[model samples]
Target: MNFDLPLADISTDIWDTKYRYRDGDVIRDASLEDTWQRVARALAAVEAGQEGVWAARFHEVLANFRFLPGGRIQAGAGTRHRTTLFNCFVMGTIEDSLDGIFSALKEGALTMQAGGGVGYDFSTLRPRGARADASDTIASGPVSFMHIWDSMCATLISTGARRGAMMATLRCDHPDILEFVEAKRDPAVLRHFNLSVLVSDAFMVALDQDADWPLSFPPGRTVGNVRARALWERIMRANYDSAEPGVIFIDRVNRLNNLGYEETISATNPCGEIPLPPYGACDLGSINLTRFVRAPFTPDATLDLDGIAATASVAVRMLDNVYELAHFPVPRQREVARRSRRLGLGITGLGDALAMLGLRYGSDASLDAACAAMAAICHAAYRASAELARERGPFPAYRAESYLAGEFVRGLPEDIRTAIAAHGIRNSHLTAIAPAGTISLLANNISSGLEPIYAYRYQRNVRRPDGGLTEYAVEDYAWRLYRSLHGDAPLPPGFVSATEIPPDQHLQMQAALQAHVDNSISKTINVPADMAFSGFETIYRNAYALGLKGCTTYRPGAGRGQVMTADQQPPAKPCCELPGAD
Candidate 1:
């Protein structure tokens, strides 16, 4: 008998369909009987691994993990483990190397050590000047000081035992913009951070008007270039060439910020998907992106509705349960979670999803389908989570009249709403699309977010449990789909890499897919180390043109003094043995 389990389940390597979530069915469609069955199957697998790291591996930072109806999750159990890498609040950091400029690497490190990924404004550190973000008489410039924190991140891992991830944001008004743009020109900066320049709405207006724009940092930094368009050109060139120093429209960044009422968001979690609070960690989880795409398009190939619904329903349950298994460090974090029951049920293997359905990510049809698909996922996740709330109670902040209120509350069944008013919810916000890292791996190498493959078969270098380097060959699922479209041999697209594909499609593809996701996506636009820095503007505008919540990219020069490449990177890595190491 084939005794298989979920991808991460060690019991069997085979794909376990027993607990499979059927797509195309909404919470309304899924009978409670059908929902409960899925829940039981998954929890059984999880309970089976309770004794070892398997349980811990799935544990999140702050929320407790519990299976909801249809195998969904209910966060805020033991630890309040939340989702990471999904779109959340703006996460900002004040590096304190400057003469009291910000919290030196110490506080930032402390925050990350406690389970937070950070975002930094290197522009404030001063352009490689005598004073960094601080007023200290003599100090290094922003870029130099960034290295300090980078080193700390490299040296001091997080409480989860994972290397801290961060985003460095420099405004367009800063001097040394060129230097900042080229900081990751080398593969050096890839170690501890993701980098993006904060562009303003003015910059886009200027680009459109063909006018010159000023670049300043704290009123003291100088504008290093003329012909704003020229600079934009250079940036785009760099993006196309190097793909680093991704651009973040500071104006838009604030435009979407709902918490600006309570707090200003400046930075984001590691992957730049979720902007977070100071010392904030993104508590993320996701569904399989491919699961939503049902194909065999009517003559032209549209999405398959049934498959999408089934996947969405099941994904909701799986992510809801994730909260129960997570382990967080502080009570403050738990309280943060109680306010909102947000779960990032994003898709992984979009490349695979699209591939399975025979669609190109950059194409119009695929893009349109993507939007509908995401909208559907968002819709499905919220509905299921609301149903979960019916039994589990609505998240604490679920005031039907409030701004933080979930969109689902109004659409929920009246009976469920009544249950919520009486019982309250088990989670707060239930739909966010995170960078399904481990989930993607376990799901069999799907393209991340709306991204295509990065390489076809590059040797991924990774650290092992034994402190040794291990190389895992990556299988680009996109390539498989590309090949499958032409043939029907009986095998799914194996794996394809992005390196061999057209680089221009990268940004366009992201812009196209990001339209439907309410939360931001975590995708690193890759450029070769030698790529030029002139093409960044076009890329930046795409986000604007596309109205993305936010965007980030990795350039060769941006990752200076960092780890740039992947080596069989695990879901999370080995950490310093804590008080108790099994």
Candidate 2:
């Protein structure tokens, strides 16, 4: 747990501004080590008997940046703030009645205020123009109510200093399904929400057969019918123009869920990871994969499997402690947290780690590595959770017979499965790959979660003290390591960037990891801007075929803001200048 690694200034700056804990006007935690210590101490305090021992263990993994909890845990853990440790929650089903809908809205606000993202399944609400029994008025529909939630989220900045994040999901069979899919066509609408079409198996079947699809509401009601393929085309066309309203294979997600017997997963967190039942929250963290690579661009490069397993075990414990330490904003959320005790322990820097080992991302070799790495993590996580159950007891909602029969649990190693069956596991779901964008940036620009390096190098804007902007060339971790060793020589064949990889490779990689991950993944298949609509459609179908729970693709173009650029631009003055700056 040596805290002597040379951290980049940019990485330090990101932590300082975005994650480091502060008190009023005083800078309580000045350095990354200090912040880690503060968080470790705070989380360790929840340990029943041996706080100091567990605090030291937590600091061991945290000091070297090997294990990173979500941003909520980083900023709020030690600050004694009235914020929740969980990153996001799927709110309880919204009732169709006017009073029930508004009540859910109020609960969403409270959750957002406490710095937690929220997701809702709007299919429960009746379609537009549906009858209101007591009021004798037509219902305005779920989309209209979503607008209210959007406005509320826009106004409430979470405790982490970011605007609230939301996910609005609608079932494909809903009467207003078409309207819901096209709602985000206007960029101004649902600005604060990420929309997803919950594609049921029946819709896919109808789509494949080129048959008519029924759109219905309450009690087997069929309000309209449309050509399934044609409706799917509209969805693709809209996404081609604007990058939103991702597709989630809802039926597949539920079918594979470990808790499927007792819970139904209707929606996911904002980033499309961790599909959860109502009031379910994801207590998330990631293991820095780059830290486990034994050699850089060498013929004998190898991954430290033991290191990965050990870190994952500690990470699971830390994240489980998060459930105990978390402060839920709503009573139902608290109830759900206590019942499910879900934890999303994923990996970051996967692409960089692959590159460092002289393996091209999306190649068969890299895919094998990803599968092995993720398997080790999942196995270790379940083992640790079982051990925890022996000491702290299983989650309240855990049912051994049903849980062991789950697709994911059944696939686990025999030893791990036996242990779980004997003692049960602390958490229902153990793994998810989140879009760890900011955390990866904080970790010295390592490649994001399960995503290929966007570019080898890109210019970044940094504000100077004198009110001017300075441009720094940020290099991907493996690229930086290559340059340091090879000195401006062309990148090796292993250094494959995101744009160079094909869409299918992305799906292959995701499917490989998804096998080991009990929950869904938050990965973007970066496709070329000029990719054909037919090809884009194929990507999602292929994703479903590959057993993926969800598919999100990012094609850089107009309407979709630029995320990465290779071209250099002139440095300009800062947006807001100090009064007396020269």
Best by TM-score: 2
Candidate 2 lDDT over residue span 249-338, tens digit each: 999999999899998889988888889999988888989999898866788889998999999998998988887778999988888878
Task: Give the CA lDDT, 0 to 100, for residue 546 in model 1.
Answer: 71
**Minimal lDDT window, size 10, model 2:** 573-582
Off by over 4 Å in 1: 1-104, 110-116, 122-136, 157-161, 175-179, 210-227, 230-234, 237-241, 258-261, 289-307, 310-341, 385-433, 453-458, 473-508, 524-537, 550-582
Q: What is the lDDT for 477 in model 2?
A: 77
Tell me how far candidate 1 lies from the true structure as C-alpha RMSD in angstroms. Answer: 9.9
Q: Rate the local accuracy (lDDT) of all candidates.
A: 0.50, 0.84
Clashing pairs in 2: none
TM-score per candidate:
0.66, 0.94
Candidate 2 segments exceeding 4 Å error: 1-5, 158-161, 460-473, 568-582
